[model samples]
Target: MVQNPERRTVLADAAIEVLARDGARGLTFRAVDREAGVPAGTASNYFANRNALLTQAAERIHVRLRPDDATIAAMARSRPAPSPEVLERELTAMYHRLAVQQIDYLALLELRLEAIRRPEIRAALTATMRANLEQNVAAHRESGLPGSDVDVVLMYLALSWLIIENLTLPGVLEGYDADRLIAALTDLVAGR
Candidate 1:
């Protein structure tokens, strides 16, 4: 197979814009075509269908946010390494960023919602999310904590989702202060 960087770039960019504006339900071949200014047929040619497009778009997002191996190594070397306290703080920030950042969070939500109905998309999302979790687990492990344990990794994952869930829960915005949440998480991670 030949690589057409420009075409792939166009498709990927178009996919993100479409997802951002329309969510999963609004993403379709023709919609992307219009958004990307490409022929409908051409957009379809590249993506084959909506699922393929979403999977690629989600992967793109993952790639953009995931720390490169070299960066991870540098972090391992220079950083004081995370204690449970630091881990909690870092995760809380990540949760806040994802929830408050409209485009990124919305796109991720779209991928997740669609993944429920599409097995292929679901698998792709699971794999991508797993990779992200593993990276975090590795960092935690390197920090001289008990992070390498399956239990620690599982706990972090559960806590991360709780952050997301609480943000979306009813009355959370009215009752919860974001800064307080972050501070509380810091203490929680410290095992206070």
Candidate 2:
């Protein structure tokens, strides 16, 4: 409802930080406003309700987590042909990049938990996640990257769980190098 797109985006991002740090129950207009360093009523004016705030937060997470096109293109060129080594490098690079955004990824995980009971959140996440997945699969396929569509799907599941495990329960994979783990996936999919 807020006409200032930049301010609204700022509030939504603040809501993400609040949600991740404070959990669903702690996500309030005041919290978001405080996080954004805006006026106390700023978030309330920007969002229609808590649900709207939640949905916008989800959307904002999608935007924040997206890799820029230049990065994608560089990755595409990193491995000009389909091979196990190519797949390994690509996956390893992707994992490294995502690992750097620890906070944003954790925020996404929090949003997933909140989505369970909120239909609006579930719907928004589903739509954007589906689109993102499809786009990724297409990119992988078109880039002549290693792995079949089925492999892409499987790796997607594995990588997502890997991220979750690394973020939420780091000790579970203690002593194991994340890049090597991703390389194992490349092996399985690329027929090495």
lDDT of 1 at 149: 54
- Cα error of candidate 1 at position 16, Å: 3.1
| Candidate 2 C-alpha RMSD relative to the actual structure | 1.4
Candidate 2: what lDDT? 0.85
Q: Over the stretch 83-176, how does candidate 2's per-residue lDDT look in tens digits? A: 6787788788777777777778878888898889899999988888888789879988887877888889898888888887888899999999
TM-score of each: 0.73, 0.94
In candidate 1, what are the lDDT values of residues 69-106, reduced to their tens digit? Answer: 79667645765555665566555655665555456555
Positional deviation of 151 in candidate 2, in angstroms?
A: 1.0
Clash pairs, model 2 backbone: none
Candidate 2, run of 10 with poorest lDDT: 72-81
List candidate 2 stretches off by more than 4 Å. Answer: 77-79
Which pairs, if any, clash in model 1? none
Error of 2 at 3 (Å): 1.2
